[model samples]
Target: MTSTTASRPVGAKPAQGSNLSLGSLLRRPEAGAFLGLLAVLIFFAAFGGLTFLKPAGMSSWLNVAANLGIIAIPVGLLMIAGELDISVGAMVPFGAMTVAVISGHYGMSIWLGIAVTMAFGVTVGLINGYMVIRTAVPSLIVTLGSLFAVQGIVLGLTVLITKSTSVALTVDGPAKVIFGDFLFGGQLQVMVIWWLVLTAAYVFFIHFSPKGNWIFAMGGDKVSARNAGIPTDRMTIVLFVLSSTSAAFVGMCQAILYNSAQVAGGQSFIFNSIISVVVGGVLLTGGFGSVVGIFFGTITFAIVNQGIYYTDFDRNWSALIIGVLLLLAVLMNNTFRKMALSATTKKKGA
Candidate 1:
């Protein structure tokens, strides 16, 4: 729905950039996650001992974190902007397969395939945004539908064209070098650089720009945001499109890195991304979160998800541990929220 500049609550100052001070560090959005990372490290080191802190071990965990963090950052932005796009789970496979189709099966250039993948991403994002706006359906349902529909389409099309569910990609080229090559003494994947760049860019935009305030407003209350002169619909569309496009970009990278794409490869991302976001302290209900928190949260999740494999623990126990982590994260988030609100109330009372 269109919003106009007369409905926002009076006296709403634009969202403020973080004020830096020693005090500010404690109040930093990601402070909780930093503590959580330390806690995780301590727990693993105490239990798994030296193996948990090995360079090779650390690299593996960071690699998974980097891949997931790429998508998490964009999705977190979209969340901050007050929209959702579950279709990313599907978009991952879609983009990868699209790349594979163009570059692998059709003997097309990888750059060309990457471009097509991006274009397809934009199209899918446009459709998602349009459907959400037109029907006023919650994005959860809209994107979930997109998720399944896209998944089916990818599977059906892959089988129809290649008669195989998996495509082996010969990803040796400039595209591979650009996306999949090792950096940081060959201990880090190139995508880690991309993640850091995206995170910094997001932090700058959301913290320093007027448009960032608009995003916070949209999430706080769309109708009120519209009344206050914010273009909620346009912002929503842009956020969704960005979300999808980011997923597609990551998918292309993965296809090149792995040298293959399977229709089912992206399924884990749906939940994994959400877990990271939530652990970062973004409320499921929207309106309050920190991107830096998400960055650390993604790291924490990656450590737990991948690091668990290094231990002698049973695989099933890893799921159990992750579940416990999720529960603890939610519990701590609520406690912190209450504490912050109480402090705010006390200050006003004084």
Candidate 2:
């Protein structure tokens, strides 16, 4: 009884103080992204006033973010796994044309068109992954090759078959309701719902699933990960497939929503998705990122993109603002990452 030491139950964990909890929170991958998002929201709110916070103004960016977020997540995942897939640019139009040609031009079932479009995505993804794995070529170069090839195919087939660069589609059934319809007084798209749902699924997959560790391992060191029996090759292929298929899905949904598909559109996705991923705090060198980070990065970008219109600044300055804001976000992310690393080092040393 004279002993001053407090007794604890066997296997009990030590309680974390508030400072420790905060430190742990800041060490999370999404922490920088969250901070960046908050900074941008505050910045825009100060300049753009209440209108920017309104539902109408919010929807403008939300719609853009939803479309970009879908593509950015998988691309971010690929980047996290130490690979890249720029072929997504071409896959978008390919998906649009495939569905448009099948469903709109030939009057075939929309379901058939959807099926074939997805199949094409899978085929292209498999090719990209196989080439990357087998040839020892850089993933960048491999996807770049597929990007141009798919573009040419889309252009040639659309012109040859339809004699036009654009095709129109009209859907009158459940497909329209699910994929293309608007919600909440038409201020938002159904895609936003899909974006939220997909983001949740990805978060769980990456953070909670056993396979998620394999991704980090692959990104950190493919050779070592393979040695550990992580099935790196199959994981790479699956990531490629997800990236390509997601791009195709976005294109398909766009075609469905707009009632038309253009062979020339969707090229911006390549750069845009990359920008979103980077802004989300994924390291370009790989092995670090979170779906939540990508999600926040996307919303941050959409805000910077559309927030300009709501501000008093000149419209021509939008691009400049976007560039500056993105640069700041990247810098913030890097700073936080370094701090997290330093904190971990100190703790380990302690």
Candidate 3:
């Protein structure tokens, strides 16, 4: 009888050459995102002049990207896993308010406030994940429900206890230095450091670790992945928790940095994070994306958003400019993705 495993020798190397060619590089998921980032950066630099490239100017967008990226990475992961978590919109303000109310209004310890804020974030995330998994409802609907519910809670609780929609916080010592302070002549928020560290961790987790493949598999086909013995349910819950908690973390830091929290301010994060993820090349339909892509995409969006201020364009036209540029970036990313796929197909046929 023929041996079942005789097709190839154990530990044998493939006959093909190394995959370090330019074409192979371009086939990477982050390649298009990098290109898009370059295009936007050059476009802004050309129009906005040297001032746009200055350290101060760069910090403007980098700071914005840092805050948004923290949320976008996890949100993108959820998207890649065929899920969405819009509850982050409310989680931002909820986190801000939680920290503000505890540390500012009640005169509690800053550490206590941070701990409570994170705990609340974890609790809400757990609820969101449990609801989505058990109810069989789309994550969009579940998070949407939580979004409004959280918003209502923030408004009601803030008004009931603080008697105002805005709360002021004054953080000192280690908390301020670690979470809310600026670095390098007060131009860069400490959040940038956190964002970078977290992105590196995520890159390692998603690309190098075994669990990363499980996430992609879950995104590609959850039922099939589960049947293949992947822990789809647990992973889904973990992603939801990450998304919600990241949003809250961003908000908590903002409250500390700005020294105040408002009830209505964080709604912008919802669309902005989604736009960043999509522009980074994550498909709205899920199953394809990269952390590096999301990082570049966030930077691209931030540049487009802030670069307008440096140019002579009318402030009113900023919205139009941002929309058009983002649309073009998305198209470019799609084109590159198609090219990559075509190259792979041709190679396989050969």
Alpha carbon deviation, residue 321, candidate 2 (Å): 2.3
Cα lDDT for residue 19, candidate 1: 38
Per-candidate local distance difference test: 0.81, 0.87, 0.88
TM-score of candidate 3 to 2 decimals? 0.93
Ranking under lDDT, best-scoring first?
Answer: 3, 2, 1
> What's the ranking of the predictions by TM-score, best on top?
3, 2, 1
Better of 1 and 2 by lDDT: 2
Worst 10 residues of 1 by lDDT: 16-25
* CA-only RMSD, every prediction: 5.8, 4.8, 4.8
Per-residue lDDT for 198-274 in model 3, tens only?
99999999988889999999999999999999988899889999989999999999999999998887888998999
Poorly placed runs, candidate 2 (over 4 Å):
1-20, 348-350
Q: What lDDT tens digits, residue by residue, belong to model 1 across residues 1-350?
A: 11233454576443522234333344444656777777788777776776756877877888888889888877877777667778999999999999999899888988899999999999999898888888978898999999999999999999999999998788775778888777755677888888888888887777676787888788889889999998887888888888888888888888888889888878788888988888887777777778888998899998888777777777677777777887888777776766655654554454
Q: Model 1, clash count?
A: 6
> Clash number for model 2?
0
Of models 2 and 3, which has the larger lDDT? 3
